[model samples]
Target: MNIISENKSKKIEIEENKSKILDIKKEIEEKKIKIEDKKKELSKVKDMAKGEKEKMEEYKELKKQFKKIENEIYSTIAPLKREMRKLEKIVTDKKLKKQIQEYIEFPVKTFLNDSDLNVFRESIPNIEKIEKNPRKREKILRLIEYVLDGNLEDKKKEYMAYKEKVDSFVITSREENKEGIIKRKIDNLQSEIIKSEEKIKNLETKNDLLQKEILKSEEDIIEILEKDLDVKVQE
Candidate 1:
């Protein structure tokens, strides 16, 4: 009876060991599955971080371009602004003053061109009707003089002899303000410079946001590496 009991006990002990071994294998499989899931998560985080890094580089390049454009614009327009200020000091007519201010503000190439001259010439008849009123007459005459002065300078290079003589009267009567002609060109450049500066400011704001996004992405990547991978990030 003792010998039979010993054989049964040995059989039971062997079965218990087999069960423990199976349990350990199942636990190892579960851990392996968890590790694989974490690896996938870590890979996704790295991809996100890489995308953010690329965006940061792109933003930096864009910022450089914006800065370059801004500098070029300032260099081109600064001299023109100074010239406009100098011209402003010499002109006394309120109409001309307003025109100068408009030129500086708008700065378009086609402004105050031949078409504008033709329009002014056509309006002379209407202006003559207002001449009976001294206040209105004087204002109209000043406007005409300013327009004619500008037209004369613009046409001098294209028209000759008799036409030049006829056109010269417009500027000659006004004490020959050559600076007024230059003011028109300065205005156009100033407008371009202003536009470039606005673009730069907008790009600067975008770059700031991109930088913040990159920083956040890097932090997330570090957290994933440390928590999931159980590794320390060097930098």
Candidate 2:
């Protein structure tokens, strides 16, 4: 073929490769959407299962109890952490300042880890000396008193008890119930998702190959324009 005709053919080849890549990408997106739909169907199936559904309700109740205690503890400690952040700026003692830093950074963990408010008790005298705002200092003292009074410790114990009960609870799925009778539905959806994923993978591999072909065609086009026609290609 003449150089001009050869160049035209290479340009067409690049466009064809790009068109094939776009088609493959469209197919991949469709497969992904199908996989998501299958997963949603699977979730609906599990929710319909009578035996597992009742069991999930029990598990949800236990979690509800645990969350109530968890919220109470954090709600009480949240203000303390804010107060500690204020103190962190003005505290003079290195050890007290660092402890306050830890409290501000990880309020729940530090508060639970410190037994009997030992760090606060040790720094109380220092805090009183440096705190300039009477209202803030009073609020800090009251919060410290709350921590030392064993109320938080009692709640902590309760939290741990509920936590263990929640964690130790088990969830098992059975296929024999009236709702669970269509376990095959779940199996079929899972199979569909797997097949859709495999198709996407194959499409991706094909697209990558097409990309290499497009690059080769473009390179050939550039060479023909620059060398055969003695043309100045912009790119």
Best by lDDT: 2
Lowest-scoring 10 consecutive residues by lDDT in candidate 1? 106-115
**Candidate 2 accuracy as TM-score:** 0.46
Clashing pairs in 1: 107-187, 107-188
Model 2 lDDT-worst window of ten: 171-180
lDDT of 2 by residue, 95-198 (tens): 77887887777777677677656556754665665466899888777877787777788878887888777776642333334434657777788889999999
For candidate 1, write residues 1-235 as lDDT tens digits: 3434544554565555455555545555554565556556556555655665565565556555544544443343333333344445555667655655554564332232334543344335545443457776676556556656663343333333333444454444356443454344445445554554555555455555555555554565555545644533433
The C-alpha lDDT values of all candidates are 0.49, 0.77
Whole-structure CA lDDT of model 1? 0.49
